[model samples]
Target: MNENKTHDLEKERQYYTNQTKELLQNLKEINEQKELTESELREQVMARIGAEKQLQAAEKALEHLEMALKMTGAQMTELQEHIMPDVHKLREYFEQCAQEAQLEANRAGIMRQAIYARK
Candidate 1:
């Protein structure tokens, strides 16, 4: 009877050892799965941050373009105002020159007639 009790106790010890090994394996698998999930979450967060940075850059570019366009429009208006007086002055000078040329031509014609009459 003492030998049977010893054999039964040995069997119980072996069964407990097998159960502990299986539980450790299950725990290891859970830990690996958690690590993989954490890695994926980190990748997604980095991608979102990069996208946000790109959006900010695009917004800044748009603002710069808008300011440049406004400045160009104002400069165009100023140039138009600055050039109008010069255009009017140029037109008046051309008319005066045309009148002087016509008067010189008339005088030359009269001189030619007088020379022919004298001949």
Candidate 2:
């Protein structure tokens, strides 16, 4: 009877030891899965942050472009309203000078032809 009790206790001890080893293996697997999930979450967070920064930079660049476009529009307005009339007046004066010079050139050519005929 004593031997039977000792044998039963030994079997119980072996079973518990096996159960403990299995539980430890399960805990290890759970820990590894948790670590993988955390790593994935960290990577996702970093990617989102990078994308948000890029979006902000894009918004800033668009603002600069809008400002530049506004300035260009203003410059165009200034040219059309203030400078085009002066440019047109200068163009008319230049045309008048060109016409007078052409007339003088024609007169000089006629005089040269007459002198050649006389010679």
- Which candidate leads in lDDT? 2
Q: Write the per-residue lDDT of candidate 2 for residues 36-111, one digit (tens) a residue.
A: 6556655655665565565556556555654554567654786556655655565565556556555655655565
Residue-wise C-alpha lDDT for candidate 1, range 3-71, written one tens digit per residue? 999999999999999999999999898778666655665565566556556555655655565455456
Evaluated with TM-score, which candidate comes out highest? 2
Model 2 TM: 0.58
Candidate 1 lDDT score relative to the true structure: 0.63
TM, every model: 0.53, 0.58
Q: lDDT score, residue 111, model 1?
A: 53
